[model samples]
Target: MTVHNYKLTVTWSGNRGTGTSGYRDYERSHVISADGKPSIPGSSDPAFRGDATRWNPEELLLASASACHKLWYLHLCADAGIVVTAYEDHAQGTMNGDRFERIVLRPRVTIAAGDRALAMRLHHQAHAQCYIAKSVNFPIDCEPSIE
Candidate 1:
């Protein structure tokens, strides 16, 4: 078995002036960076006093799951001789307090020519193989429509 390791740095950048002296004293902002990659601006949910302009952990988690599934699905489609033209996913996550209850991925796909039934089936296969979906404890459901 082969294992891959990933690493990144998260530096807090929200010390307003006095630091975390009070609950609302500091901003919930940070930078996420890895070697040879662009840095990501991160913050908490806007409801939690975070900057809505920056990315939040919940959104990032949902993006990761969606991206992983998309990558796997595309690879499977390619190997199966299905020609995919366009793909877009509208993914959503439900969080009850601090824990995520579930994530739903709504992918709209446009194919030049392919088996519609097989393309739909590939979503289940993609979800089963997605690393992020496998790692997460919550359910990740894929609702895919092919055109």
Candidate 2:
């Protein structure tokens, strides 16, 4: 077993700064994000409170699963002697409800100019071996559109 970790930090400053007027304003930041760019992604929504355009942990977690799965697909294809010409994945995710909502990541993986049978097998191998997909409790589904 292996472990990976990252350090994240966020900060904010602006109108509604630490006040009870519902003006709740501040800048979000991250310590090791975008190479030390301390600006967390945030929406203009009054609910967001105010911040940058950095994806939150939940979204990032989903992305990690997608990325990891893609890499695993490539690895499995290589091991299986499948020559992949190209690959693409449109990964999307959403929260169920509440601040701690359950999230789901759906990845549609596409392959180009490869053996159909081998690609199909690699697709399954990728999903079965991806660490992030296996780790997350949420529903991480992959639609392999191998071509």
Candidate 3:
């Protein structure tokens, strides 16, 4: 079996001079950067004394799952002769205190008229094939609406 490796750098950018002197001293802001890609401004969730404007870790987790599933679904559709037009997912992740409970991927997909049953089945296949979904301990359920 072949294993692939990925790497990225996360740099803290929120030192407010004093630097973690107290509970509210330092900012929760940081930058997630990788080669040949744009940097992502990251922070803790606003509920945890973070910047509301930055992308939080919780949201990033949900996004990773959603994006992974979408890519896999599209690949399966193409291979199965299901012509896909539009695809979007409004993914929601639920957290219980500090731990994640579940993630729901509500995907709205538009396809070129074909076997609807097969199109629906591709969602299950995509779920099974998603690397991120398989890695996460929390449940990732796909609720897809094909049009």
Candidate 4:
């Protein structure tokens, strides 16, 4: 097996003039950047006094899982001779207390040419093979609609 290493820098941009002198003094904002990649504006959830316009960790986590599964599913579909025309996912994650309990991936797939049953089955295979799904402790469920 081969192991891969990844690195990124997160610079806190939440320092208000007071600089954490009080609980509500600072903002919950930051910048996430990596070499050759565009920086991502990040902030805590709105409930935690974060900017609603910025990306939050919880949302990013869901996106990561959804993206990983989409990539893997496409690859598997190609190898299996299932032709997929388009795909989009509206994935959601549920948090229990301080941790995530589960995530559901709702993928709408458009198939130009392929066996619908085989295409649906590939979702299960894709979930099983997704690295993010394997890494996370929570359960990831896929509900795919094939067209």
Error of 1 at 7 (Å): 1.2
Kindly report the root-mean-square deviation of model 2 from the true structure over all alpha carbons. Answer: 4.1
Instruction: State residue 88's C-alpha deviation in candidate 2, in Å.
Output: 1.6
lDDT of 2 by residue, 22-58 (tens): 4433344332335555545533323454344545565
Give the backbone clash total of model 4.
0
TM-score for every candidate vs. truth? 0.97, 0.66, 0.97, 0.97
Give candidate 2's TM-score: 0.66
Residue 129 alpha-carbon offset, candidate 1, angstroms: 0.2
Where does candidate 3 stray beyond 4 Å?
Answer: none
Over the stretch 17-132, how does candidate 3's per-residue lDDT look in tens digits? Answer: 99889989999999999999999999999999999899999999999999999999999999988999999999999999999999999999999966788999999999999999
Sort the candidates on TM-score, descending order. Answer: 3, 1, 4, 2
At residue 142, give the lDDT of candidate 3: 92
TM-score of 3: 0.97
lDDT for model 2, on a 0 to 1 scale? 0.61
What Cα-based lDDT does every candidate model obtain? 0.96, 0.61, 0.95, 0.95
* Ten residues in sequence with the least summed lDDT for candidate 1: 110-119
